[model samples]
Target: SLKGEARAGVQFVKAQMGAVSPATLLGLGVGAEGDMAERHAHHHHHHEDEDHDHDHDHDDFETFQVDLPALQDADLFLERVKQVIIDHDILRLKGFAQVGSKPMRLVIQAVGPRVDSYFDRPLADLEKGKTKLVVIGQAGLDERAIKAALQS
Candidate 1:
Protein backbone atom coordinates (compact mmCIF):
# COMPACT_ATOMS: atom_id res chain seq x y z
CA SER A 1 0.00 0.00 0.00
CA LEU A 2 2.83 2.40 0.72
CA LYS A 3 4.27 1.81 -2.73
CA GLY A 4 0.84 2.29 -4.23
CA GLU A 5 0.41 5.66 -2.60
CA ALA A 6 3.95 6.61 -3.59
CA ARG A 7 3.36 5.47 -7.15
CA ALA A 8 0.22 7.53 -7.40
CA GLY A 9 2.05 10.59 -6.24
CA VAL A 10 4.91 10.00 -8.67
CA GLN A 11 2.46 9.61 -11.53
CA PHE A 12 0.94 12.94 -10.65
CA VAL A 13 4.38 14.55 -10.92
CA LYS A 14 5.09 12.87 -14.24
CA ALA A 15 1.98 14.41 -15.70
CA GLN A 16 3.39 17.84 -14.90
CA MET A 17 6.51 17.21 -16.99
CA GLY A 18 4.34 16.91 -20.08
CA ALA A 19 4.89 14.46 -22.96
CA VAL A 20 8.50 13.37 -23.01
CA SER A 21 10.52 10.36 -23.91
CA PRO A 22 12.47 7.95 -21.68
CA ALA A 23 11.50 8.31 -18.07
CA THR A 24 12.54 6.26 -15.07
CA LEU A 25 10.77 5.62 -11.78
CA LEU A 26 13.09 5.52 -8.80
CA GLY A 27 12.48 4.70 -5.13
CA LEU A 28 14.77 6.61 -2.77
CA GLY A 29 15.09 5.92 0.97
CA VAL A 30 15.82 9.06 3.01
CA GLY A 31 16.65 7.30 6.26
CA ALA A 32 15.14 6.55 9.66
CA GLU A 33 12.28 8.55 11.14
CA GLY A 34 14.63 10.54 13.36
CA ASP A 35 16.81 11.55 10.43
CA MET A 36 13.76 12.68 8.52
CA ALA A 37 12.85 15.08 11.31
CA GLU A 38 16.35 16.50 11.51
CA ARG A 39 16.51 17.16 7.76
CA HIS A 40 13.09 18.81 7.67
CA ALA A 41 13.96 20.92 10.66
CA HIS A 42 17.22 22.02 9.11
CA HIS A 43 15.41 23.00 5.96
CA HIS A 44 13.27 25.32 8.07
CA HIS A 45 16.44 27.30 8.88
CA HIS A 46 16.55 26.15 12.49
CA HIS A 47 20.19 25.10 12.42
CA GLU A 48 20.98 26.69 15.77
CA ASP A 49 18.35 24.71 17.63
CA GLU A 50 19.41 21.39 16.11
CA ASP A 51 22.75 19.62 15.83
CA HIS A 52 23.26 17.57 12.68
CA ASP A 53 26.32 15.88 11.22
CA HIS A 54 27.19 17.72 8.04
CA ASP A 55 30.72 16.41 7.56
CA HIS A 56 29.75 12.82 6.77
CA ASP A 57 26.34 13.35 5.16
CA HIS A 58 27.89 15.13 2.23
CA ASP A 59 29.98 12.07 1.42
CA ASP A 60 26.92 9.87 1.45
CA PHE A 61 25.00 11.91 -1.06
CA GLU A 62 24.67 10.60 -4.63
CA THR A 63 24.37 12.91 -7.62
CA PHE A 64 21.78 12.55 -10.36
CA GLN A 65 22.68 14.57 -13.46
CA VAL A 66 19.78 15.36 -15.81
CA ASP A 67 19.99 16.54 -19.42
CA LEU A 68 17.57 19.28 -20.34
CA PRO A 69 18.93 20.31 -23.70
CA ALA A 70 15.49 21.12 -25.03
CA LEU A 71 13.91 21.95 -21.72
CA GLN A 72 14.28 25.72 -21.51
CA ASP A 73 12.79 26.24 -18.06
CA ALA A 74 15.32 24.67 -15.70
CA ASP A 75 15.37 27.39 -13.09
CA LEU A 76 11.63 27.33 -12.90
CA PHE A 77 11.63 23.56 -12.55
CA LEU A 78 14.18 23.69 -9.74
CA GLU A 79 12.22 26.39 -7.98
CA ARG A 80 9.06 24.37 -8.18
CA VAL A 81 10.82 21.29 -6.84
CA LYS A 82 12.37 23.25 -4.00
CA GLN A 83 8.99 24.67 -3.10
CA VAL A 84 7.39 21.25 -3.13
CA ILE A 85 10.05 19.76 -0.90
CA ILE A 86 9.81 22.63 1.50
CA ASP A 87 6.04 22.64 1.64
CA HIS A 88 5.62 18.85 1.97
CA ASP A 89 8.48 18.16 4.38
CA ILE A 90 9.23 15.10 2.29
CA LEU A 91 12.47 13.40 3.27
CA ARG A 92 12.54 9.95 1.70
CA LEU A 93 11.05 8.66 -1.51
CA LYS A 94 11.23 5.52 -3.66
CA GLY A 95 9.39 4.96 -6.92
CA PHE A 96 9.91 4.52 -10.65
CA ALA A 97 11.99 7.17 -12.46
CA GLN A 98 12.14 7.24 -16.24
CA VAL A 99 15.58 8.27 -17.40
CA GLY A 100 16.43 10.39 -20.43
CA SER A 101 16.07 8.52 -23.68
CA LYS A 102 15.76 5.34 -21.70
CA PRO A 103 12.60 3.33 -21.82
CA MET A 104 13.42 1.54 -18.57
CA ARG A 105 12.41 3.17 -15.33
CA LEU A 106 14.77 2.49 -12.45
CA VAL A 107 13.36 1.91 -8.99
CA ILE A 108 15.70 3.91 -6.76
CA GLN A 109 15.45 4.48 -2.99
CA ALA A 110 17.55 6.02 -0.20
CA VAL A 111 17.50 6.80 3.54
CA GLY A 112 19.24 9.43 5.63
CA PRO A 113 18.70 12.78 7.35
CA ARG A 114 21.75 14.78 6.35
CA VAL A 115 21.76 13.77 2.71
CA ASP A 116 19.37 14.43 -0.19
CA SER A 117 19.19 11.94 -3.06
CA TYR A 118 17.53 14.27 -5.56
CA PHE A 119 20.64 14.65 -7.71
CA ASP A 120 21.82 11.06 -7.45
CA ARG A 121 20.38 9.79 -10.70
CA PRO A 122 21.81 10.38 -14.16
CA LEU A 123 19.99 12.56 -16.69
CA ALA A 124 20.71 10.08 -19.43
CA ASP A 125 18.36 7.74 -17.59
CA LEU A 126 15.51 10.18 -17.05
CA GLU A 127 12.67 10.69 -19.50
CA LYS A 128 12.35 14.22 -20.81
CA GLY A 129 9.31 16.16 -19.60
CA LYS A 130 8.68 13.42 -17.07
CA THR A 131 10.22 14.24 -13.73
CA LYS A 132 8.10 12.22 -11.35
CA LEU A 133 8.82 11.70 -7.66
CA VAL A 134 6.84 10.10 -4.82
CA VAL A 135 8.13 11.19 -1.44
CA ILE A 136 7.19 10.03 2.09
CA GLY A 137 7.70 12.18 5.11
CA GLN A 138 6.70 12.71 8.74
CA ALA A 139 3.75 14.77 9.89
CA GLY A 140 3.51 18.57 9.45
CA LEU A 141 3.16 18.40 5.71
CA ASP A 142 0.71 19.43 3.01
CA GLU A 143 0.41 16.83 0.27
CA ARG A 144 -2.14 18.78 -1.72
CA ALA A 145 -0.04 21.93 -1.71
CA ILE A 146 3.02 19.92 -2.68
CA LYS A 147 1.24 18.39 -5.65
CA ALA A 148 -0.07 21.77 -6.66
CA ALA A 149 3.35 23.30 -6.31
CA LEU A 150 4.85 20.68 -8.60
CA GLN A 151 2.21 21.41 -11.22
CA SER A 152 2.51 25.14 -11.01
Candidate 2:
Protein backbone atom coordinates (compact mmCIF):
# COMPACT_ATOMS: atom_id res chain seq x y z
CA SER A 1 0.00 0.00 0.00
CA LEU A 2 2.87 2.35 0.71
CA LYS A 3 4.30 1.68 -2.71
CA GLY A 4 0.93 2.21 -4.29
CA GLU A 5 0.48 5.45 -2.44
CA ALA A 6 3.93 6.54 -3.44
CA ARG A 7 3.29 5.69 -7.07
CA ALA A 8 0.02 7.55 -7.15
CA GLY A 9 1.57 10.56 -5.45
CA VAL A 10 4.39 10.54 -7.95
CA GLN A 11 1.88 10.51 -10.76
CA PHE A 12 0.11 13.47 -9.24
CA VAL A 13 3.31 15.47 -8.98
CA LYS A 14 4.38 14.48 -12.46
CA ALA A 15 1.00 15.54 -13.78
CA GLN A 16 1.52 18.90 -12.16
CA MET A 17 4.77 19.07 -14.07
CA GLY A 18 2.81 18.63 -17.34
CA ALA A 19 3.42 14.93 -17.75
CA VAL A 20 0.84 12.26 -18.39
CA SER A 21 0.98 8.62 -17.33
CA PRO A 22 -0.46 5.43 -18.73
CA ALA A 23 -2.27 2.96 -16.48
CA THR A 24 0.78 0.68 -16.53
CA LEU A 25 2.61 3.08 -14.30
CA LEU A 26 0.16 2.31 -11.51
CA GLY A 27 1.60 -1.20 -11.07
CA LEU A 28 5.17 0.01 -10.79
CA GLY A 29 6.51 0.72 -7.31
CA VAL A 30 7.91 4.22 -6.81
CA GLY A 31 9.99 3.87 -3.64
CA ALA A 32 12.11 0.97 -4.85
CA GLU A 33 15.23 1.78 -6.83
CA GLY A 34 17.51 -0.23 -9.10
CA ASP A 35 19.99 -3.10 -8.28
CA MET A 36 18.34 -4.93 -5.36
CA ALA A 37 14.80 -5.01 -6.71
CA GLU A 38 14.00 -8.52 -5.45
CA ARG A 39 15.75 -8.19 -2.15
CA HIS A 40 14.44 -4.68 -1.59
CA ALA A 41 10.89 -5.78 -2.35
CA HIS A 42 11.12 -8.63 0.14
CA HIS A 43 12.68 -6.47 2.81
CA HIS A 44 10.32 -3.61 2.14
CA HIS A 45 7.26 -5.83 2.62
CA HIS A 46 8.67 -7.24 5.85
CA HIS A 47 9.43 -3.73 7.09
CA GLU A 48 5.86 -2.66 6.33
CA ASP A 49 4.57 -5.51 8.42
CA GLU A 50 6.87 -4.52 11.24
CA ASP A 51 5.64 -0.97 10.96
CA HIS A 52 2.02 -2.09 11.24
CA ASP A 53 2.93 -4.16 14.27
CA HIS A 54 4.42 -1.11 15.90
CA ASP A 55 1.93 1.49 14.72
CA HIS A 56 0.60 1.89 18.24
CA ASP A 57 4.04 2.75 19.53
CA HIS A 58 4.24 5.64 17.07
CA ASP A 59 1.04 7.15 18.45
CA ASP A 60 2.77 7.89 21.71
CA PHE A 61 4.48 11.28 21.60
CA GLU A 62 6.73 11.17 24.63
CA THR A 63 9.85 11.81 22.55
CA PHE A 64 8.44 14.79 20.60
CA GLN A 65 9.02 17.40 23.26
CA VAL A 66 12.13 19.59 23.04
CA ASP A 67 13.48 21.26 26.19
CA LEU A 68 16.30 23.34 24.73
CA PRO A 69 16.36 26.96 25.82
CA ALA A 70 18.84 28.07 23.16
CA LEU A 71 16.40 27.85 20.27
CA GLN A 72 14.79 31.28 20.39
CA ASP A 73 13.63 31.98 16.80
CA ALA A 74 11.55 30.03 14.28
CA ASP A 75 13.75 30.85 11.28
CA LEU A 76 16.84 29.77 13.17
CA PHE A 77 14.99 26.66 14.24
CA LEU A 78 14.17 25.72 10.65
CA GLU A 79 17.75 26.54 9.64
CA ARG A 80 19.07 24.20 12.29
CA VAL A 81 16.74 21.49 11.09
CA LYS A 82 17.95 22.08 7.54
CA GLN A 83 21.48 21.73 8.84
CA VAL A 84 20.65 18.50 10.60
CA ILE A 85 19.11 17.10 7.45
CA ILE A 86 22.24 18.09 5.55
CA ASP A 87 24.54 16.43 8.05
CA HIS A 88 22.65 13.19 8.64
CA ASP A 89 21.90 10.96 5.70
CA ILE A 90 19.80 8.32 7.42
CA LEU A 91 17.54 10.39 9.61
CA ARG A 92 13.83 10.68 8.78
CA LEU A 93 11.92 13.89 9.43
CA LYS A 94 8.15 14.32 9.93
CA GLY A 95 6.58 17.50 11.14
CA PHE A 96 4.69 20.70 10.33
CA ALA A 97 5.43 23.82 8.28
CA GLN A 98 3.75 27.21 8.72
CA VAL A 99 3.99 29.97 6.19
CA GLY A 100 2.71 33.51 6.60
CA SER A 101 -1.04 33.95 5.89
CA LYS A 102 -1.56 30.21 5.57
CA PRO A 103 -4.13 29.11 8.10
CA MET A 104 -3.42 25.41 7.68
CA ARG A 105 -0.37 23.75 9.14
CA LEU A 106 1.59 21.98 6.42
CA VAL A 107 2.36 18.59 7.83
CA ILE A 108 5.66 17.51 6.33
CA GLN A 109 7.43 14.21 6.81
CA ALA A 110 10.66 13.71 4.92
CA VAL A 111 12.21 10.31 4.52
CA GLY A 112 15.96 9.98 4.15
CA PRO A 113 18.58 12.61 4.89
CA ARG A 114 19.45 15.73 2.91
CA VAL A 115 20.21 14.57 -0.65
CA ASP A 116 17.20 12.26 -0.69
CA SER A 117 14.64 14.52 0.90
CA TYR A 118 11.20 13.19 0.00
CA PHE A 119 8.12 14.72 1.56
CA ASP A 120 5.87 11.86 2.61
CA ARG A 121 2.33 13.18 3.08
CA PRO A 122 0.04 15.81 4.46
CA LEU A 123 -2.34 15.36 7.36
CA ALA A 124 -5.98 16.42 6.87
CA ASP A 125 -6.34 18.90 9.69
CA LEU A 126 -8.71 21.85 9.85
CA GLU A 127 -6.12 24.35 11.06
CA LYS A 128 -4.29 26.54 8.59
CA GLY A 129 -1.51 24.34 7.33
CA LYS A 130 0.71 24.99 10.34
CA THR A 131 2.64 21.79 10.75
CA LYS A 132 4.97 21.18 13.67
CA LEU A 133 8.07 19.02 13.76
CA VAL A 134 9.80 17.29 16.64
CA VAL A 135 13.37 17.39 15.48
CA ILE A 136 15.91 15.01 16.92
CA GLY A 137 19.43 16.34 17.23
CA GLN A 138 22.50 15.72 19.36
CA ALA A 139 22.37 19.34 20.48
CA GLY A 140 19.24 21.12 21.66
CA LEU A 141 17.30 23.15 19.07
CA ASP A 142 16.15 26.76 19.22
CA GLU A 143 12.34 26.91 19.62
CA ARG A 144 12.06 30.70 19.29
CA ALA A 145 13.93 30.67 16.01
CA ILE A 146 11.68 27.94 14.73
CA LYS A 147 8.57 29.87 15.69
CA ALA A 148 9.97 33.02 14.11
CA ALA A 149 10.71 31.15 10.93
CA LEU A 150 7.05 30.21 10.74
CA GLN A 151 6.01 33.84 11.15
CA SER A 152 8.44 35.02 8.56
Candidate 3:
Protein backbone atom coordinates (compact mmCIF):
# COMPACT_ATOMS: atom_id res chain seq x y z
CA SER A 1 0.00 0.00 0.00
CA LEU A 2 2.85 2.38 0.75
CA LYS A 3 4.40 1.65 -2.61
CA GLY A 4 1.07 2.19 -4.30
CA GLU A 5 0.66 5.51 -2.55
CA ALA A 6 4.16 6.52 -3.53
CA ARG A 7 3.48 5.62 -7.13
CA ALA A 8 0.27 7.60 -7.11
CA GLY A 9 2.03 10.69 -5.73
CA VAL A 10 4.72 10.33 -8.36
CA GLN A 11 2.14 10.00 -11.07
CA PHE A 12 0.37 13.14 -9.87
CA VAL A 13 3.61 15.08 -9.94
CA LYS A 14 4.37 13.66 -13.34
CA ALA A 15 1.04 14.89 -14.63
CA GLN A 16 1.72 18.32 -13.18
CA MET A 17 5.04 18.34 -14.98
CA GLY A 18 3.39 18.14 -18.38
CA ALA A 19 3.03 14.36 -18.51
CA VAL A 20 6.70 13.69 -18.00
CA SER A 21 7.37 10.63 -15.88
CA PRO A 22 9.24 11.39 -12.68
CA ALA A 23 11.89 8.77 -13.30
CA THR A 24 12.58 10.12 -16.77
CA LEU A 25 12.68 13.69 -15.55
CA LEU A 26 15.16 12.78 -12.85
CA GLY A 27 17.13 10.45 -15.16
CA LEU A 28 16.44 7.55 -12.82
CA GLY A 29 15.06 4.16 -13.75
CA VAL A 30 14.81 1.15 -11.54
CA GLY A 31 13.61 -2.35 -12.19
CA ALA A 32 11.26 -4.29 -9.95
CA GLU A 33 14.17 -5.79 -8.04
CA GLY A 34 16.22 -2.65 -7.92
CA ASP A 35 18.04 -1.61 -4.80
CA MET A 36 15.64 1.21 -4.13
CA ALA A 37 12.66 -1.10 -4.51
CA GLU A 38 14.27 -3.58 -2.19
CA ARG A 39 14.86 -0.87 0.40
CA HIS A 40 11.29 0.32 0.14
CA ALA A 41 9.96 -3.19 0.51
CA HIS A 42 12.19 -3.80 3.52
CA HIS A 43 11.05 -0.60 5.15
CA HIS A 44 7.41 -1.39 4.51
CA HIS A 45 7.76 -4.90 5.85
CA HIS A 46 9.61 -3.65 8.93
CA HIS A 47 6.65 -1.49 9.87
CA GLU A 48 3.98 -3.95 8.76
CA ASP A 49 3.13 -4.98 12.32
CA GLU A 50 2.76 -1.43 13.64
CA ASP A 51 -0.66 0.02 14.37
CA HIS A 52 -2.17 1.96 11.46
CA ASP A 53 -4.50 4.23 13.36
CA HIS A 54 -5.11 7.42 11.47
CA ASP A 55 -5.32 9.59 14.57
CA HIS A 56 -1.75 8.74 15.59
CA ASP A 57 -0.26 8.24 12.14
CA HIS A 58 2.16 11.12 12.47
CA ASP A 59 3.88 9.81 15.58
CA ASP A 60 7.08 9.34 13.61
CA PHE A 61 7.83 13.04 13.24
CA GLU A 62 7.03 16.41 14.71
CA THR A 63 6.80 19.89 13.25
CA PHE A 64 6.58 23.25 14.97
CA GLN A 65 7.05 26.91 14.21
CA VAL A 66 9.18 29.23 16.29
CA ASP A 67 8.71 32.98 16.39
CA LEU A 68 11.32 35.03 18.16
CA PRO A 69 12.74 38.52 18.43
CA ALA A 70 14.80 40.07 15.67
CA LEU A 71 18.30 38.69 15.54
CA GLN A 72 21.05 41.23 16.16
CA ASP A 73 24.08 39.20 15.11
CA ALA A 74 23.90 36.95 12.07
CA ASP A 75 26.88 34.83 13.00
CA LEU A 76 25.70 34.23 16.55
CA PHE A 77 22.17 33.51 15.42
CA LEU A 78 23.36 30.97 12.86
CA GLU A 79 25.61 29.30 15.39
CA ARG A 80 22.77 28.92 17.82
CA VAL A 81 20.50 27.51 15.15
CA LYS A 82 23.13 25.02 14.08
CA GLN A 83 23.56 23.87 17.65
CA VAL A 84 19.86 23.33 17.96
CA ILE A 85 19.74 21.35 14.74
CA ILE A 86 22.56 19.11 15.89
CA ASP A 87 21.15 18.63 19.35
CA HIS A 88 17.66 17.87 18.16
CA ASP A 89 18.53 15.86 15.03
CA ILE A 90 16.41 18.20 12.99
CA LEU A 91 15.59 16.84 9.53
CA ARG A 92 14.75 20.19 7.95
CA LEU A 93 14.42 23.85 8.86
CA LYS A 94 13.29 26.80 6.83
CA GLY A 95 12.10 30.29 7.58
CA PHE A 96 12.83 34.00 7.48
CA ALA A 97 14.52 36.30 9.93
CA GLN A 98 15.15 40.00 10.39
CA VAL A 99 18.76 40.71 11.05
CA GLY A 100 19.41 43.87 13.04
CA SER A 101 19.39 47.02 10.90
CA LYS A 102 19.31 44.98 7.70
CA PRO A 103 16.91 46.39 5.14
CA MET A 104 16.26 42.97 3.63
CA ARG A 105 14.76 39.76 4.98
CA LEU A 106 17.13 36.88 5.65
CA VAL A 107 15.91 33.58 4.21
CA ILE A 108 17.18 30.54 6.07
CA GLN A 109 17.11 26.95 4.80
CA ALA A 110 18.69 23.93 6.35
CA VAL A 111 18.69 20.18 5.72
CA GLY A 112 20.25 17.92 8.28
CA PRO A 113 22.69 20.43 9.81
CA ARG A 114 23.71 22.09 6.54
CA VAL A 115 22.33 25.61 6.93
CA ASP A 116 22.22 28.24 4.23
CA SER A 117 20.94 31.80 4.31
CA TYR A 118 20.68 34.90 2.16
CA PHE A 119 18.91 38.19 2.02
CA ASP A 120 15.92 37.67 -0.25
CA ARG A 121 14.07 40.98 -0.41
CA PRO A 122 13.35 44.20 1.41
CA LEU A 123 11.27 43.61 4.53
CA ALA A 124 7.62 44.52 4.33
CA ASP A 125 6.07 47.05 6.71
CA LEU A 126 4.47 44.44 8.96
CA GLU A 127 7.01 41.64 8.63
CA LYS A 128 10.07 43.73 9.34
CA GLY A 129 12.32 42.79 12.26
CA LYS A 130 10.78 39.43 13.02
CA THR A 131 12.25 35.92 13.25
CA LYS A 132 9.99 33.06 12.34
CA LEU A 133 11.11 29.53 11.56
CA VAL A 134 9.51 26.15 11.08
CA VAL A 135 11.42 23.25 12.51
CA ILE A 136 10.90 19.56 11.66
CA GLY A 137 12.45 16.53 13.24
CA GLN A 138 11.69 13.10 14.60
CA ALA A 139 9.30 12.83 17.49
CA GLY A 140 10.40 13.72 21.04
CA LEU A 141 12.06 17.05 20.20
CA ASP A 142 12.74 19.22 23.22
CA GLU A 143 10.42 22.09 22.39
CA ARG A 144 11.12 24.15 25.50
CA ALA A 145 14.86 23.85 25.18
CA ILE A 146 14.76 24.67 21.47
CA LYS A 147 12.64 27.73 22.06
CA ALA A 148 14.86 28.92 24.88
CA ALA A 149 18.05 28.48 22.84
CA LEU A 150 16.70 30.31 19.82
CA GLN A 151 15.11 33.08 21.84
CA SER A 152 18.36 33.76 23.65
lDDT of each: 0.46, 0.43, 0.78
Q: Which candidate's lDDT is highest?
A: 3
**Candidate 3 to native Cα RMSD, angstroms:** 11.0
Give the distance in Å from residue 17's predicted Cα in candidate 2 to where it truly belongs: 22
TM-score of 1: 0.32
Model 2, range 26-140, lDDT digits (tens) per residue? 7465645555644432223455564445334334322233222222344555555555554432144566554454343444455433322222344345434444555543333
- Residue 2 of model 3, lDDT score: 42
* Residue-level lDDT tens digits of model 1 in 53-146: 4444334333322222322344455455555555455566444444345444444443322223233444453354455555566554466665
Kindly give the stretch of ten consecutive residues in candidate 1 with the minimal lDDT sum: 62-71
Q: Tell me the TM-score of model 3.
A: 0.65
Ten-residue region with minimum lDDT total, candidate 2: 62-71
**Leading candidate by TM-score:** 3
TM of each candidate vs. truth: 0.32, 0.30, 0.65
Clashes per candidate, residues 3 or more apart or on different chains: 44, 28, 0
Model 1 ranges off by over 4 Å: 1-72, 93-128
